[model samples]
Target: MSKILDAFLNENLEALRDQGLYNEIDAVEGANGPIIQVNGKKLINLSSNNYLGLATNEELKQVAKKAIDEYGVGAGAVRTINGTMDLHVKLEEKLAEFKGTEAAISYQSGFNCNMAAISAVMDKNDAILSDQLNHASIIDGCRLSKAKIIAYKHSDMDDLRTKAKEAKESGLYNKIMVITDGVFSMDGDIAKLPEIVEIAKEFDLITYVDDAHGSGVTGKGKGTVKHFGLEKEIDFQIGTLSKAIGVVGGYVAGKKNLIDWLKVRSRPFLFSTAVTPGDVAAITRAVEMIMESTELHDRLWENGDYLKAGLKKLGFEIGASETPITPCIIGDEKLTQQFSKRLVEEGVYAKAIVFPTVPKGTGRVRNMPTAAHTKEMLDDALAIYEKVGRELGVIN
Candidate 1:
């Protein structure tokens, strides 16, 4: 390695250390099931995105194990070459049906899907009106597309409409598109998809909704598109298999032509190896479970409401959230991180999200209460939070 590269890394590391921003990874000792063993201690898990508690589901595990027995382990090659296993095809078909779309295509991760799908159809000559608080993957995808990205105010329909009008009238780009996350992960606010659809229709803007957090959480677990009843209006619907699906991968669901175009053009889909057969089979089963029953979904909401009510009763500032993803807002970054550390020490596992991940000083302890959490578990977590808050002088 070059001496110059070594020096550059040293300088950056020193700066991060000085600012107390350098994070040391904490390894979980055991399974990521409902409860996890971290630092050799069993804790109430409130940090996982396994919303429906399907990550350790017996049926999903069996399906994956069976596929591993038959298909071995890896996909062997890129999809365009030879990695397109029957399992892959069937999973995509199931995803399309789940999303209520004509077709769908899967990627290695939700992050990869955003990068692949955004640029496959858009180019430098195009313009994109993106929500200010869209996910990091979407922002990176827009940048990679080489499109003129104009950020509209978060969840502000008027701002989106104004920007769309200006971009359309300029005629400087070949096409215009608008994109937003179906649910803002930080604040847990659902996107104003209905109004966005109206704006897209009026201005002929292509619509994209990355429903990473909304799937298996909204519209009886059908997702935001179904929640808003805009199955045909939105041009692109993106979701993650890693979240509620309890597996690893991402997908784009839309009209048949869009799916075909992405399959031919998306770089990750064409260049990277396909998801393993085990993952594909497991995810297909998870999707089927979601489609067949509302039990897990109901339990998730029940746990969420219990936690939110408990936090509120304790006088914690929980922001304007309409979904199960709850944030206990703490203003200062250092204090927020300290609060998280204290919680972990006390046996609760929520993490602190600070500036850059969220806005500056809007730091919070993000809690993801899953269906696996019982009322007693939530009560125990609330007690820990109360104790930590009082010890830290954040609460009485």
Candidate 2:
């Protein structure tokens, strides 16, 4: 409608295409699982975040259907209004238990949880010491808080300590918070939470951890805080119900006072409609399963190890990944995109990560091996990787 708006959008879109940065979304034809059908082609999927492969679990699906039958499709109103149902309450209780916290509060999504919780607690009077490589959601959350943000070297405890000391001694803010991702998704490295906790204790800083990628994958499905046995020490533990839990929504687990504060002050929770009853039920069931057994978690790691071993054997430069997330590094961005395209053509579906998402010249095809993937599926995916890597001169 507006010519200036049109021109601005067109110019930016063309620039993205010209730079080979435009992402083309692929439509999945059926359930997203170990194997997915994309554009009429069946491929071994290594691009999904369904860590434990519970996204398509039959039991969870059944529970969701039952919930739908009892409570309908939607929650009907905002959480502060009439939307907080029995299922919602139960999910929060289950999340607190799972995360080993005194209380928990849920939101529509993980992104919203970060955006809501961070700003609600920290404000202009505070300073946030964040990890350089933390998730974009954390960055946006900090900005929204209007706090002085000081970024430290990624996972470098020394840098964190230095920044913390400076911020505290300056007396520029009333409160200081240190936030980091429990597991750095891109490199698949676990954060040094123990060292961070020690630093926080020394400075009396409020500690926050976004463990969206760690829940159900670490700490025997409890999460990274439990992984390091610092459940009571950390103040905020944010997680998603969508990733390993295989549903929708996010939550912040902490003390009862913090949870109560979020319930009243978090704008998203107060104004937005609550998560669907089916999703809440499914997520609760999924967490129950994770706590009940460690079978899925073990299978996920086994598959990750098998795939990593195969890629290394084929001479591909798989980067330093301590978790199930693997990255086949291809230094050039265009070539990295081409490598991912070739993988898709050969019956594997892994996506490329380039600048903005990752540093320039470190473009990579990130693979996420799930618990549902059988050895045969992984072997086939490995074969495709080797073929593509060798053909593209990415490997010997």
Q: How far is 217's C-alpha from truth in model 2 (Å)?
A: 0.4
TM-score of each: 0.98, 0.99
Model 2 agreement with the true structure over 1-396: per-residue lDDT tens digits: 799999999999998777667778999999999999998999999999999989999999999999999999999999888999999999899989999999999999999989999999999999999999999999999999999999999999999999999999998999999999998899899999999999999999999999999999989889999999999999999999889998888999999999999999999999999899999999999999999999999999999999999998999888788889899988888898899999999999999888889987898899999999999999999988888988999988
Per-model tally of clashing residue pairs? 0, 0
Clashing pairs in 1: none
The RMSD of every model to the true structure, in order and in angstroms, is: 1.1, 0.8
lDDT of 1 by residue, 346-377 (tens): 99988888767888778899999999999999
The C-alpha lDDT values of all candidates are 0.93, 0.93
